[model samples]
Target chain A: MARIDLVDLAHSYDGGNADPSSFALKPTSMTWRQGGAYALLGPSGCGKTTLLNIISGIVKPSRGKVLFDGRDVMALTTQQRNIAQVFQFPVIYDTMTVGENLAFPLKNRGVGRAEIDARVHEIAKLLDLVPQLDRKASRLTADAKQKISLGRGLVRADVAAVLFDEPLTVIDPALKWELRSKLKVLHRALDLTMIYVTHDQTEALTFADTVVVMHEGSVVQTGTPEELFLRPDHTFVGYFIGSPGMNVLPAEVEGRQARIAGHELSLARSYGGLPPGARIEVGIRPEFVSLAAAAPGLLAARIERIDDLGRSRFAHVRVGDLKIAARVPRGLSLGGNEAGLIFEPAHIHVYADQRRVEGAA
Target chain B: MEKIPNQKAWLLVLPVFAIVAFSAVIPLMTVVNYSVQDTFGNNKFFWNGVGWYQELLDPSTELGGRFFASLWRNLAFSGAVLAIQIPLGIIVALAMPREGWGVAFSLVVLALPLLIPWNVVGTIWQIFGRSDIGLMGWGLNRLGFDYNYVANPIDAWLTIIIMDVWHWSSLVALLCYAGLKSIPEAYYQAASIDGASRWAVFTAIQLPKMRHVLVIAILLRFMDSFMIYTEPFVVTGGGPGNSTTFLSIELVKLALGQFDLGKAAAMSIVYMLIIIIVCWVFFTVMTNAGADRKGAGGER
Candidate 1:
């Protein structure tokens, strides 16, 4: 296992002369500790896959150094780098049985036949593929095929890391959870550095120890699931992590007060020296904001709709022209369309130009 | 749900039957009729029974000797053609550009030979292999090798084989190229990540992926080479010593050259049966091998 470092890594499918803004992967630097489970989370064309490919050495970055264990590996091919990658679709040798598929990496590396067999069986057992050891990999279900793909990745003991490029995309819905948890289990048992690239938040949130949220080719935030939900560094992170997402509204900010739609909300922290002419906004999670009966101090809103999500209800409220999501308190009777929103002072975050501002508490 | 028996469904299949009857069945029947009868120049025929078949099957008889010799020649020719073409085609396919403007240029150039008419291919090679006028023959002789396709049997065989390979190797290559194109980029990436070498990638991934197409290429090449008559016949006209007389050439000689209608019809029928049977056996074996693996996996 190796700690992977991306030292100002950047890439553009077009050559070096291309404009910096058009790069598929914008300049970024981050380090992943050995044996850490990390997920690169982003929507399609957000450069997550490009980043993953760069890590795996499938695509060479146009700039920057990739260091493994503090050694620059720019000239190393993927095989020389000793990384394993499972693709979005299951990629197994159709002519080979599951056992042979698992043994492929070892065999290619000229590992002893006995050791290859042992490793194959061990990986197969871990993947619950012992019964399918001799069966053709091509004829297996998509989930099983993905499992075989995973098994192949895990068979080699000396691999620096195993990279997954949305490996569970083709799995059945019911099987996705099973395979996902299986991956989590494998990560624990094998103690290999696993970097999973996916757009699905649940997959990222559940599988990763630290989730790196990306937007438009740049990493917006890198934090644990709770941290991402509680304190998103960027507006994209806040809007992407939570179910209803953090409700962001165009606002005017001064000191600890944020005025939205001509109404004021107090802040727990004092904000000073705000960037001039920046697009200022206030973000609050729906879980923190509560719907109440129209009160004098509360911000007035028109309840557009209430979504009953079993454990809780969120009222989609319109405050002036701005729409906001506020939690509907249990055991409260609503008499009319008009309601008031109470934004929890501690939960409110100030943003300028789509990036969170750190205020003095 | 109750079943509805509609007899009109069979009527929908009438066009297929009519087409098959006119295109295949009636012509085949005419051959079958001719195979069992003796016919003269006047078209007056008499039942010859299996007398012609018996003579054709017995190697001691003149008809049997000629048939066996030509059949062996056809088999050898097909074997040689397959042995050379399959690997050459695969190599060419591999060497082809995977992308860019070069891909279009390569594809067009590769298809040029296959687009030529069979007789035209024959004529081109016939002159091309001439010691007096052709570049290849003139060049070879000038380089101190006595090469004359018109006079030497080995030279004649080599020329025809080379001609056949040139004319048809592109078809196999094109088919293999198509097979290679269908493989997702992920497979190669996965193989590379697996630490597979070039040979390992070819054997473990590419070769297996191209199995279906390779089977088609082999079958087509085998059938076409086995029944080949046009090119070699044009080039050598069965040669100075009947050296290039393949089965089709022999059959044509018997039917048109010698006017032996009974023997030629029987020979053509036998040739058709051999092709059908060989193709059936080959197809069955390949498909079953694929099926066996699927069956062994068992459903989830």
Candidate 2:
């Protein structure tokens, strides 16, 4: 396995140097470590597939160098790079039996017959496809075909890496979890570097040790799932990672004090000499916002609606013109139309110009 | 509770039944009637029973020998056409442009011959194969090959085969091209990533996916070539001592040229049965091969 490095990579579909609006993938640099399970997470058209293709050498980047283990591989074809890619749709030779499908890559590389047979059998057993080894691949269910796709990649022992581009999209919902866990088991058992591209946050968070979140053709944050959940690097990350997302309120900041809707609030960190025209906001997760009795620094809001969510409840409240969602524990009784909302000091984050400010405790 | 059968569905099907009766059954019955009896010019018919059928089946008789010879010729012509056209068509289809303005232009050009009527195609080839005025014949003669389709049996056969190829190869090519286009880009991409060579990709992916279309092309070409008449009739009139006389030409010569009604009727029935049996065999073999590959899932 080899570590993949993308240096100043960018892609424009129109064949000209692209402006921000036209570029399919914005210029950026990142490195994927060997034997690491990583996910490129984003919505549709967010360039996750483009980035995956670039890494796999399927698409030549318009401007960049791709290095495999510090060796420049920009001129190498996909075959020369020796990377295996599984597509969104399962692609198998319909005429071939499952055994032959798994053996195809090895055979293409001119591996010996006995070795090819051995590898095919090993992979088939790992995928629980031993019984289907003699059956034609065209006759299988979609998930089974996808398993053959995965098996073909795994059958090659000398591949640099295995890349998946939304490979679970065609699988049934109940089978998705089983295949996902099977992927994780294979990754651990084989110790191959795997890069999965998907638009589903749950798939990314559960599958990858390090998840890279992209928004609008650029990466917004790359971190462990816990870090992303706790401290999002950009406002998009905060709004994208959680169920109800974070509540952001417009604010004006000066030195150690911030004012929101004419109420002065104490700051967790100092913002000395802030830019003159920079828009500022306070971001807090709904889970961290608490309901409290009247207290100093607590903001009063009118509770518009309360939704019971079995183990917890969501209190939709309005403070002046701003709407906020606060997740409160079940059985917490509150009678009035108005309640004091308290922001947990350690959980509160500040953003300036849509990026998290540094020194926010 | 026992449910009453709905008999009114027959009324709904009556129109189709009437159409088939008028179009197929009545004419076939007339042929059968002619096959079993002897008829003169004044509507006087006498029972012939199986006399004409026995005469047609007996190889010692002149008509039986001619029928067998013509049948063999028809089979050979169809076999040669299929052997040449199927591979040539696939190659042409593969060479066709995949996208952009070139695709539309190439498709229209390839489809030009198919849009022409059968008589027009015959007349065009008839004039085009003449030694005095035709390009191919004049060019070959100028090159010192002594080519004349009217006088030489081999030259006449060659001219007819070439004309048939030119007229119908495009149909096969168009069908194959459609099949090739339906393949997803992902299959090729995956093949490339697997380090498959060009020939491997063709055999493994392209050929397997085009199997159904190829079956259709084969069946159409086989039936059409076996019953071919107009072009050869126009070009050579089954000339050079009946060297190129196929089953259809021989049947027409019997029915219309000589007015031998009973023998012609028997030959027509035999010809129809042969076409049906051959087509059924081809369809069954190809479909069974496909089903074997696709029936594995049902086995579970």
Candidate 3:
């Protein structure tokens, strides 16, 4: 168990010899505390997995240093780093028995045969794979293969951290729930520093204790799941962390209020840096939007379409020139008439150039 | 289902099956016809009626002496190739990159030898193994070992073996490379987090993951090696007194040079049967492995 610190690590795939624009990951610093379950969540090509690989010593930073337990590992190989990583697709050996696959690391390290057997038995039992020890790994279903992948990753007792890069993506849809919960149990039982990378919001939110929201090669925010959902530090985090995402609208700020779609919404807090007519926007989660028949509140919106999302209904609405989503409780009688969009004033967030400007008042 | 009959699907398989079957059927039928009868110079035929089979077992037939010797040589050659290629190919595959520029570069370089024709590889090596022009021969001759592919049996065998390694190790390498490539990067991540050593990653993750491809590689290499004629023949002409004469080269000598059509036919049938049996053994091992993993029936 070790704490990983990435210090001002900037990685450039473009050789970094030409220009400053060649950098993929600009100099960024962050820390993952020991035993913390962190997920690097971002869209594809956003450098979430790249950052994780860099942390794991698969990709070294072109500048700065990566520290594990306060020791610089800039010149270390992945083997020297001793990081366990699970890829998006299952990577278990097909030829070996499931038992052998699980016990591989122990065997490789020259653990006693009896001890290896016990550890393999324990892990297989924990993974509900006790009955499959004798079976070759290739014939197992995709889920079982993935479980072996996880089991192999967890076999070693002295690993620095366990890094999962979209490990659940290849699992059958029905088995994703069970395997994810198994990983959580293994994490708790072992208390290893685990960093999972995924673009799936629900998986990131549910599986990780702390979510590190990354966008375009930089960490936008890292906080507990609730903190991420409730108060995102950046516009990307706001849009990325929520299902249907947060609704963002162009706005003009004056005094204590922000005007959006030709109407004003009260700001909970004021920012001294943002200019009056600057490129400003107000953001709120779709889940917080209250539907109305025909009245004025924050602004008026036209219900374009209603999407039934089981527990809630997302009314695809048009707020002036912008299309925004307002999630109402399932079976709300929303009409095509100008429906007033109401949100708690304290929940409103104002952004200037993709950075948060208005604080909660 | 009637509305969308899978005609397009068959379009994909038709070309491959056609090419494979057409190439296999004619020569096989000729071998079969020759196996059942004896032919003379004027095309006079006599019914042999399993005489060659009795001779094959009796060890008294003129066919058995040179034939069995080459058969043993072929088996030994296949064993030696397997002992060297699989582990070496896998190591090369592991050292290569999973993606990016390194991937394409490694692939192109590794694929170079596999693209050369069998005869060309033999010719290239034959020249390269010469004491005069080839560095290997020059170096060997410089050391006064008296290495010559044309005269010495051991040297011919060694040259053929080296030439075989050079020509075909790449196929195994490329196959294993493809296998290694197909492994999801997730496995490496899993291995890394497990605190597995690099060796553990290769043995547990890389080797196990490459089983199917390695099996295919082995089978293809085995069958190809078993049927090997062109390379060894071009290099040693099955000479240096039969040191490098494999089963196929012997079959060719019998059928083409000596005109022993009936014996050649019988041997070809026996050769085909041996190939079939070896292929079956590999198939059995692979299928059983696959079945044991599945936790159910072996049926596809």
Candidate 4:
């Protein structure tokens, strides 16, 4: 079992920057438990890759403490860190035989030749690369090359954690899904700590036990996939973790009612002490929103457009000047002019500034 | 759906092929004609079948042994240049920073020597090695030794080797530098995460990755050195007898100095054949190495 603790970590490509604007990753702290498949999920330039690189020792953080199993690894080189990283593009030696590339890391660690062969074949078999073991990497297809790269990382069982940095970006869609599932299964069987960095919510949700949602250069939210989807603490996580994203509309809140386009929605009876004049935002997952004919419901919105994505439907509704998207089940024709929208009080997340406020008072 | 027939594209390239053939084939035919004929002054000619080839291969002939010796020196010179240049090039490339002002700075400095023309490089070395006026020669002489390249064969050889190293070593370094630069930063990252030592990074990753460029650098240096003439000819004039008279210098001595075009043309063909054979061996070695990496990936 391996546990990693990162403390006060920040990085800037430029030597010294007193301001956060000059830094790529803001100062942050985190602890990852052993055998947990955690993912750093964010868009490009969100510092997920930078954080992964820092953890792997490829990138040295400007100010930080990186501890693997309670031992500080910040000053240690990448080799000393004892991590395995797979990059966006496959990086196997093109001249080396597949078997050779897989065997190399083992031999470098001074593993016996017989043991190296045994481990290489075992990992190759797991990755479905046994048939191509003798072929040159240059002659292999893109998918095969990436498998060799994956095998190289997996061949060594002693590493603290396996870090993946968008390793499936170059692979085809079918292979991508298969490979993602394979990683999940392998993590379960081996019980190794895995940190996968990806911008795709589906991959993060499926492959990671804990999804750390990052935006700009800061960690916005970190929880299980269900926790993130059902209760996003930050507006960025709300928008980033779901398809059709959660619809965030401006509102005026006073006491128990939140007014939107002159239509006020009552908060739960429990919330009674929200501070006044705070910039209030109402967030509701598209899947939770339902259209009703009644007027005393949550809010009033005009149906702007409807997008059909096979099994589910997305209705873009206009609430005053703001647009909110609601995910509707199949076989429902959303009318244009005036439609009542309702959400369970539990799913209606209220926010002050960008941070989530407690159940609306 | 009706099938679309494939059209011939070579018809579009016919004129380019004709022009290339007209220019190259005619000149090669002239050389081949000269290689098999005996011609004295006044354009007098007699049929000489395999005459020059036989004389050059014959050990008893004076000029024959000279041809073999010159060829040997040419081969040895190419080997020496490869042994020194390729590894030196890789070292310089590795030491060069990946990006920023340093890379730009190193690039400009490396480019400076390559910009000098071959003959101009020879002229500069020739002047720089003069005993009376040149810095290196005068400095060496002042240390109490005869260091005259014009008279001494050993001095001339050293000068030529140094001149070649200075003039062309930059090219090998630059090619290797490009190869090294093209390697993705991720490979180093992977090696680092693998806990690969510095020597392992160089041996397993850097050196193997530079194999393609290394082969190219060797081929370029070999071909160029095997046909080297201008620099050594301009610097030492193949002087102090035939010590520095490589195949190209000897060819010139036969065709221009003695006006024996028949013998010179025959030697030129033999020289071309040697280069082709050596280049073939190099290609074979590289292809086998590439082939050995088979089955590492999927269906090729």
B72-120 per-residue lDDT for model 3 (tens digits)? 9999999988878877887787788877899889888888888998889
Question: Which window of 10 residues has the lowest lDDT sum in candidate 2 chain A?
Answer: A289-298
Q: Which stretches of candidate 1 lie over 4 Å from their true place?
A: B1-12, B292-300
The CAPRI-style docking tier of model 4 reads acceptable
Candidate 4 lDDT by residue in tens digits, B220-263: 99999999999999998887788888999999999999989999
Give residue A201's error in model 4 in angstroms: 0.3
- Evaluate residue A105 in candidate 3 and report its C-alpha lDDT on the 0 to 100 scale: 68
By the lDDT metric, which is better: model 2 or model 3?
2
Clashes of each: 0, 0, 15, 14
True contacts kept of 4: 0.56
What DockQ does each listed candidate score?
A: 0.57, 0.53, 0.36, 0.44
Q: Residues A1-361, candidate 3: write the lDDT tens digits.
A: 8999988888888764646555678778998899999888999988877788888888867888989999998888787787777777777665578898888767766789998888888788889999999987767777778788788778776788988889888776778888788889988988899999999988888899999888888888989999988888888999987878888888787657777777877766875567655678888898888776767454778888878777778888887689888867555575555787777777778788887774534
For candidate 3 chain B, the 10 contiguous residues with the lowest summed lDDT are B291-300
Indicate the residue-level lDDT of A132 in model 3: 91
Interface RMSD of each: 3.5, 3.8, 4.8, 4.2
Q: Decide which is better by DockQ, 2 or 3.
A: 2
lDDT of 4: 0.85
Q: In candidate 2 chain B, what residue range of length 10 has the lowest lDDT sum? A: B291-300
Compute the TM-score of each model's chain A versus the native chain A and list the values.
Answer: 0.98, 0.94, 0.94, 0.95
lDDT (Cα) of model 2: 0.88
- Top-down TM-score ranking: 1, 2, 4, 3
For each candidate, the alpha-carbon lDDT, in order, equals: 0.92, 0.88, 0.81, 0.85
